[model samples]
Every structure is written in structure tokens, then in C-alpha cells.
Target chain A: MSDAAAGPLATVTLRVDAAEIDAFAETLGMPASPVPPTFPIRFLFHPEIRAALAMFLPADGSLPIHVGQRFRYHRPLTAGETLTCAVSATPPGGARPFALVRLDVSDGTGAAVCQAESEIAIAAPGFTWDKLK
Target chain B: MNPPRPGEKLAAVPIGPLDGAAIERYARASGDDNPVHLDPAAAGAIGLPDRIAHGMLVMGRLSRLALGWRSDAVLEAFECRFTRPVPAGAALTGDGRVAKVDALADGHRVILRLLARDADGAIAAMGEATLRLPG
Candidate 1:
């Protein structure tokens, strides 16, 4: 994947709801006092973000495999904060077809709070990088 | 508490013989309603034998382990690479070892090498984490 091909694929806004955080923590069997480090992943499921991701998914309804992830926390996230999450993807490369996805999250004031990177494999049977490109 | 020495193995934390119900709860809570994790039929359509667990769920479990390592420790970064899929009813265990420790002005910067393995002893995921432990 060339640097030029790596550009913002989608941007979505999410409000950090304490209730949702609680639910997420509860589901994972963790304490809810502090937001879980991986909670930002929920932003990927935002309707707009999902729409953007659909562009790379297979028409046959096969979901991409999440092969890797990385999270960097700038500071602790607080409840009641509005966050802007920007997602970008590199063109699929490597022996297996996989794309590197990056998510940049900032608070309403635009200060960076966290960043996440994920590697997703789209190499299910009959799927090819050409289809995504 | 004393700072962890390099190469010290952290205790293993058992996660699950995960079932569909747990996966569904995660989907509901995280808003990830991917059919591949929810519907076996959808998973089978794509060649998966059964519904699979969310990779993020495994990461969350590992994060919990890291956080609980020390009350004064704060997580700064976490990274993981999924090596294999965790099918429904498969259990997982997470463990880590202190890889490096550097004394900082306020505390220690600790690097941990982490792994999650399936019941069959196959590595399901492996990664590293960075945490700041107060002196």
C-alpha cells in the first residue's frame, strides 16, 4: 500500500455514554469505574463508519477477519465527552490480502485522546484485494 | 509492591469456554452486530464452521489482565495479533511476562509480552503492552 492510497475513509462522531461504557464493562466482566481501554472500538460500529467499511467487504456477506490491533492512549477518556473518530485504510497487501486500518480519536476540542490501528484480513475464499481496490 | 523484574511470568487468567450467549452479549453491548459472530448460518456461509468470538473481546480480556497486574499501574498502550479464530465453546487463557522495565522519573515503564491460548494449547493471539507503574 502506497502512502497516497492511505487516506481517510470515513469520519464519525460518537458521544461517550456512561451507560454504554457500563454495559461494555459488564459484558467483559470488568469494573466500570474507568472506561475500558478497548471501548473506542465501538466507534467502528457507528452507522456511518459501518457504511464506509461496507465498501471493502465482500458482496457475498463474508466478514473480514480481524487479525491484529493496537491501542495507544493519550489520556483517560471521560464520560459525557463527544469524540470525533476518523478512520483510514491502506490498500490490501502482503502474501495474504489484508489492510491496515487506523483510527484517530479526539475530544470535541480536537485534542487527541487515543489512536487505534487494526489489521484485517479480507482473504476469505473467492475474495481478492482487487475487489476492494 | 515491588516492581516486576524482567522475564517474570504473570499469572494466567482463564477467560472462557465461550458460548453463543456471551458472544451475543458482547455484540449487544459493543454495537458490533456482525452476523459472523451472531449467526452460525452466516458464519458457515463464509466457511467458518460455527460462530466465532469477536477479536476485540479477547483484547478486552487481556487489557483487564494488564490493568489488574498492579493497582498503581496505568495502561499506556496495547497491541495484539490474532493468530487463529476462537470458535464457539472454545476456552481461552491469557498470560504475560515482563519483557523490560525502565525507571522513569515518576515510576517505571514496563513492557509486557502477552499471549492468549485456546484450550487445545494453540496460540490464539500474541501481543505486547506498555504500562506505567507508580513507584
Candidate 2:
């Protein structure tokens, strides 16, 4: 489990787009700004993480519900800035299948921007994570 | 909005009428297309009454409030507990206050307490953030 969790599950670079930022702001009923505070989570998404969660997904592939989330930002991320993130997933000890993902984001200049952690709790019972690992 | 005193209550800002459109837009922008957020049928299949909005969406409102405190400030730490599920289309509000204030060598560390409440006025999520502002 440790070995599987040690290596990064994915890496993706994204140029923050004004439109995407606008879309996010629209959801919160806020007018467009440089960037929304939670916008950094965009870089954390990847196929591998999706596939991992798919192992325990409900028939419709909805989710493991998001239980908690946290972030530490070095600076405010703004629109049009390019950033990359390396993501790692770790399942904490428990019978219930739940996991935490950490995304370490860096700007185009390679300076650290922020670290976002998301905790997801799965309601899947009787599924063996050993198969996925 | 009081003078940043500990335990001072800030005016509540109405957050979401978090509908399907908003949920889908957030999913697309954040790249988190967990079907439960987009597909009501899928959500019901899993026993949810309907597609649930993302927990981070609630917390994001708090983040916005914290950043609005000072344009020059940075969020040094932010942590939140998802107390309950916020359904899509719920009229939610963002509420928070100053929890503590400390003088650091480089800046003033203001601790903030945050809450997002669903329409029933029950707390859906709660947490605290520490923001560092210039001295």
C-alpha cells in the first residue's frame, strides 16, 4: 500500500484561463475576478486518480463523497498563469475506504504556489482495495 | 465586520443557490466530474436524495471571504470539516469571524472561524483559517 501510495499518481500542467475562472466565479454568484481561491484544484485532476476511484465507484461513477479539504497557499493564484501539480494519493487506515490526495502546485517559474489536500470517503462496502493496489 | 476583534461576527454573505448549472460548471472548471454531482439518477442509485454539491464548493466561499480581507494578505493555512452534505440548489450563506489575532515578527496572523449553512440554518461545514497580513 505504501509503495503504491509513494509515487505520484499523476502530473499535469494547466494554464489558468480567464474563461475557466469566470465559470468558477459564476457558480459562487460572484463576478469575475483574477481567479477564484479554490481554482487550483483544477490541476489535480487526472485519469489515474479517476481510474483509482472508479474501482469503488457506484454503478454511475459518481464519487467517494468529499469529506474534508484544506489548502496552504504561498500566493493567490490568478488567471492566465501557468501552473503544474504533482499529485499523490494515500488511503488512511480504516475498514471504510477513504483516501486523501495532495497536490503540490508550482508556477511556470517553478516556484511553489500551494498544496491542496482533499479527503474523500467511500460508502462502498465489501469491495477489496487489495484488487486495486 | 467589526474591528477584527476576536469573536466578532462578520456580516453573512449569501453564497449559493447552488443549482445544477453551477455544480456542473464547477465540476468542469475544477475537473471533478464525479457523476454524483451531475447525475441525479446516479446519486439516487447510491441512496442520495439527489445530486450533491461538492464540499469544497462550500469551503471555497470561505476562501473568498478570507482573501477579501486584504488584497496583500495570503492564506497561510485553511482547514475545514464537512459537517453535512449540501444539496444542489440549497440557499446557502457564508459566515465567519475573527477567531484570534497574533503579532508575528513579519506580520499579523489573524485566525478566522468559518461556516457555511444550508437553508434550514444548520451548519453544513465549519472550520478555521489563518491569514497573514502585512504589519
Candidate 3:
């Protein structure tokens, strides 16, 4: 993962692996052809993106709870296609201490493929915005 | 197929009694190896009663139910809010209703309000989807 310019926190290249899609399809008991609408969310959990998210997590063992998700597909993603994914996150805030993470995926030709956003609730006592960089 | 009228209910899809192995498969497939969804011990340490299913996995099943409503329609957007965590061994059923429909030059744009209910009929998650049906 490399540092991205102003908007995105980091960027990484992702391939739409057929095997992974098959596994996902089997798990959901769906056909693998059209690529499930929520399939692109897997991109958000890429190791690189996880590493980037680690910074916002509290030192405590408290796990972040996934509270919300949204996906907008510009076109159906196909297996074996390589794409670029850029991820960005908001600082943990609000009375509940939550963060919004956004992911933008683009095809090899720089065309938009999909965009996903997830909301995670961080449950750390006494946590404040000042604690984050 | 005829366009569905507002307030029409779509067929419900029943999902698992999501056992550990099923959650593990989804963990591997999605690369979301978060211990909270995999290891019971890890989940316990974090104050959870047991390992929970991945929220995305639940959303995937709900999206499948919505997609099945119209074969010719393409899902343009989907948004879900995980109101409750689905513990291991929980069974869920996805349901949706046509919220609105708009006629475009080519086809109709449909909006669907969705929900995932636990075995007891408690809401685990709620969502909305927009699909484009070509003429």
C-alpha cells in the first residue's frame, strides 16, 4: 500500500479473482456470473487497507462494530479483471465514536467500477478525537 | 415481467443457521479475517458472547433476494444498516417491498426497502436498494 494524495489514505491494486468469486458464490448460494452487488466490499478488507485502518483503532482490545454499508456500482465487475482500490477514513467521533470509511474502485483504463462506504462504531471508553493523528 | 407496484412484497429468502464453518468460509472468501467473526475466544475477549457472522455476508444474501425480484434489472445501489449482530448459529430471513417506481425513457427505476429478520422475527439489519429494469 502506498500513501495517496489529499483524498485517499492509501491505494492498492486488486484483482477480481475467479476462485474467490466462486467461493463467495458458494457461500451465498448464488451464481458467480453477474458478481454480487456486495462483492466489492471484500476489497475494503485487503491487508493494505486493514493496515491503514489499524491506526484509528484504540489500543484496547475493543473491536469495531460494523454498523452500516453502502455500495454504488457503475458497472458489473467481472472475474479476472484487475482494478485499483483507494480507501479513506474519517476520524472516530460522535457521541457513539464511529468512523466512516470509503473505498473507490476503478478499472485498468481508469474508469470507475464501484464505490463502497462502511460505518464502524468504535467502543473505547474515554476516547477522544485528540487521540488520533 | 410487469413492473411491480409500490408496496408490493417480494419473495422472502431464507438464510442459514449460520454455523462456524459457514462463517469461516465467508471469512476466507471475503478476506475479512477479523477474529471477531472467526474465533470464539477472540470474540469473548472483546466482550461478545460468541463469534458473529460478518455483516457483509448478511448483506450479500439480502442483495441476492432483491436481485431475484427482477431478472432483467441491474442493481445500481444498495445500502444497509446492521442494527444487530448476528451470532453464530442464527437463522435469518430476508424480505423486501417495493418502495417506489419511476419510469425512465428506457425502463423503470425501482426502489426497494429491505430487512433481515432473525428467527424470532427481530430485525437484524435493514436496507434499501435501487435497480434499473430495461424495457
Of the candidates shown, which would achieve the greatest lDDT relative to the real structure?
A: 3
Instruction: Please give each candidate's TM-score.
Output: 0.91, 0.83, 0.91
Per-residue lDDT of B120 in model 1: 75
What is candidate 1's CA lDDT for residue A14? 84
Off by over 4 Å in 3: A1-7, A94-97, A124-133
> For each of the candidates, what fraction of the native contacts does it recover?
0.78, 0.64, 0.70
Docking class of 2: acceptable
The CA lDDT of each predicted structure is 0.83, 0.73, 0.84
Tens-digit lDDT track of model 2 for A53-86: 3543345333477777788888878778888878
Q: Put down candidate 1 lDDT per residue, B1-135, tens digits, no spaces.
A: 886899998889987757888899899999888777888887777667888999888888878778888888888999988877789888899999999999999889999998989977888878798999887
Relative to the real complex, the DockQ score for model 3 comes to 0.48
lDDT of 1 at B43: 77
CAPRI-wise, candidate 1 is: medium
Q: What tens digits encode model 1's per-residue C-alpha lDDT throughout A36-55?
A: 99998888888898787777
Provide the TM-score of the second chain in candidate 1.
Answer: 0.94
Error at B108, model 3, angstroms: 1.2
